[model samples]
Target: MHGRQLCVCVCAAWFLAANGEDVTCLSEYYMGREGFRSVPLSPLVYTPIAHRPDWYWKKIFQMRGIDPESVKSGYTEAWLAFLFVEAQEAMTVCSIEGGRYWDCILDVRKVYDLAQGSARSTFAGRLAAVFGITLAAPDPLPGHLRLSLCAPARCTESQVVQEIFPLAVDMLMGERPQQMLGNASFRDVVVAHEVAGWHDFDIDFAIVGVNRCGTTSLRKNMELHPDVVIKGDEEETILSYELANRLLPLKAQVEEYNAQVQERITAKFKATGHRPHIVGIGNPLLFQSALVRQKLALMPQLKLVLAVCEPVGRMEKIFMMEKYCHDDLPAAQKRLVAWPYRDGSEVCFPSTSALLTERHGQLKLFWDQRIATAQHLAALAELFPSRLFVLHQTELRDTPSNIFNELAAFVGLRPFPEKIVFRRYNSVGGHRTDLCFNASLVRSLQRLLEREYVMQESILQAFRGIRIAARSTRCDLVDKVDTTYCPNMAC
Candidate 1:
């Protein structure tokens, strides 16, 4: 148990007298007790409901435009509607940039005017009509140019417009949140049947871990390949945390996802008459979830990818996200000098002194997250030794095409169809680290690495580019710190 779960699992013990002998009854099992998931510390209760009948689910998929079996050829230039299949009512503001891979950024305005006022150009017409869009139909009205959908129990349009839409837009587009505010270059643009094409394909692999460690840029570059189709949002996924931690025993959602994957194969067979070789996603946070073992148990053939960067550099990225994940960088930068570790920011951004107390636990947890990667890797090793691939961020940044070619070869993916021009979407980390670095804190942080040393070392061996407390790395205070506690520390 990492000891930071927010679920309220209330337990109380009552002493009872049964024929003069004291007997105890307890409400819940404690951590490390039997019947608990060892890693997440959540109760292990995965009783998949018996398959009663799924005759209607296919119809539901067809109705939702997820199963595009009926759409004929020449529908190649079709659009993807951002569907909220579950919600009864929703609102979305969708903006589109055309072509194979489009650049789109959505913003919810109290109302903003279009670029060409009242002009009759087709793009402008579409923009004017969709500016205050409302999605009421469970019936998906997909056409040539749509990319977002949502339905939620919102009290007022004001509530949906002002709060929910922007949050959803930011997440769906950035694959990470609030990053759209700074970079206009982040996108994975499709989430439905029309534009994704009816090519029968199986998910060949999963990029599961080391979040904030170049997984975003990695997923983007890989997606650029003509052979790859990212089924779900790489940044925020329906397949990662939601699939792993379903707090209810109602049903296993993976069954439906598995069914959808299978249907894609069947759909492609009917469409092009040839099955495609690959479809995959990167739900980076899944590497640490209780679902790791559960997923392997279900899809044992699944290949895993972990992006590794120097630990401290990874933490510095973590620090940036914690401080500014919700706010845009320009606006956030304005607030920086005024409120260093401001009041409303995430808890981890506590003042420098707290680095010894509250921040100590936070920093420890961050490294523990890195340590947890070892546990997942060990499990993958036992299951299938050759199934896991480690991609180092340093290598990816320095020589984009070469590292991509190596990963592509490992995963059976074709090479990039064009010249590999890699662009990083998050530039906030390039700022001055003097704003948040403390040498003692970094040294102490490296001390915590001892717990996961052996496991981390094995992974480092697998990927030579993996650096530990190296002065050449991008971490906040590596050069400034007097010493690194990690053994064999080198650039």
Candidate 2:
């Protein structure tokens, strides 16, 4: 019989015996129809037209109570059809093959294994084994017999076939194409798999700054906006650290860091019709050059937000928090004594008189160096002139709405909806003043502020000079103007 006639005879016999219903085979039915050509299995190049035969074969298999996905060769439409017809004949239609189709099926499967360069144990193989039939070793077909019904060329060399039924192929083969065998490199595959099933996005903005200076609150308020997606509650410290250290390849590191974040932001985008204009993460320690350089390299257009506060208040809050956590005064004093200073100077726990008189200037310098103020912000501004946004911690606390509006404009986001309410989050509740430090320590910190006046003024003067120069150029003054000196100090 001709190829189409043989296929129809086999399919009709299998269907009648298996399902007790007479259905015309797809190839035979469409043989003479216009624009309908049977997909040739001998050459085995999977094309879009091959789906028609695969769909018909799936229906037949489903009618016979077999899951197409459970079959090993189900990925290739032609091979799956051959397996289905052969397995049906061997198991159910004994009259057609005279109780010998089991051997025939094995012969075909061996050819398939040889062509594909791998052996796949199938449901059909298990069934044949139950019938006490042992499959012969895979043998190379003779040249004259190579184009037989069990031809090797019918199953190999076409990834398009594997892609057609990916889930079944992945399940059977125990690997995904995108994760293991795609044309893309291993790194590309890994990155693609990490961000799979989500919309792609980039980190557009970041709030990088002082830890106790309302960064958490700012992040919370920003998330309330329709166009913003902030990934975590506080700092993504490890990611920032990795960026700073170059601990891994840049692309791999970024993908690892942002994979979960992208999923979260994508979920937000799906829930609301609004796609995020700004997706961000915050880490207070990102002010370091290494971290900043990596961030700018990845996204040169990234907008940066920093929060500033009165240096003494910031230091006091930190100290009070530490004191409250560790009640052992002597241990706390020891830790302070051992604390590494940027300038490589050590602070000894001082007596009240010593702090009040002689050691005062030394303590003041230590506190000043620890405070990231005008000098640090100015350096950041120089590097990111158009991108840096500075918010005073006091203003953010007092006038949140206005500050948020300005922040929105700076990051190129739409104004927050009037109905959206902003709530203070991660606030250090209650008074830090009630947490008493040693009287001498308080005096020492106060004096430290007093002594840093000249240096602070010089830094502020430098910032003002930049601001004045910026006014003449393209720089927009979005940062909060902080000209007023601290009331406790002489300006």
List TM-score per model, in order. 0.46, 0.44
Mind giving the per-residue lDDT tens digits that candidate 2 earns over 1-491?
A: 47764664465457555865433323222232221111211211111224344544455455557765555443332333444334332222222221111110112333233332233344224323433344444332211111101111112212112222222222223323233332432222111110010111267778887666777777778888888888776576544444332211233445665786777778888999777757877876566433343334335567888776555555655544332333444553343422222232333332333333433475455344454354455556566656767766656656778889988988888788988766665344323333223544554555655433334334335432312111110011112333332211212
Worst 10 residues of 2 by lDDT: 190-199
Report every candidate's CA lDDT.
Answer: 0.43, 0.45
Give candidate 2's TM-score.
Answer: 0.44
**After superposing candidate 1, which stretches have Cα over 4 Å from the reference?**
1-201, 236-242, 245-276, 323-330, 333-353, 359-374, 435-437, 450-454, 463-472, 475-491
Query: RMSDs, each prediction?
Result: 25.2, 21.2
Model 1 local distance difference test score:
0.43
The model with the greatest lDDT is: 2
lDDT of 1 by residue, 1-491 (tens): 22322121121112223334212111112231232111111112221222212332344344556644543221111211112111101111111111111111233220122212322133233433443333333122223232332223221333233222333343222222323333222122222211111111145777776776777676766766655555654353554445343222112344555566666556655665656557677766766654343343344356677776665555554555453243344455453422234555455343433434644465667545656666665654454556778766667657777878877887787676556576654333333344245666666655654444456556656654455433334545344544322111111
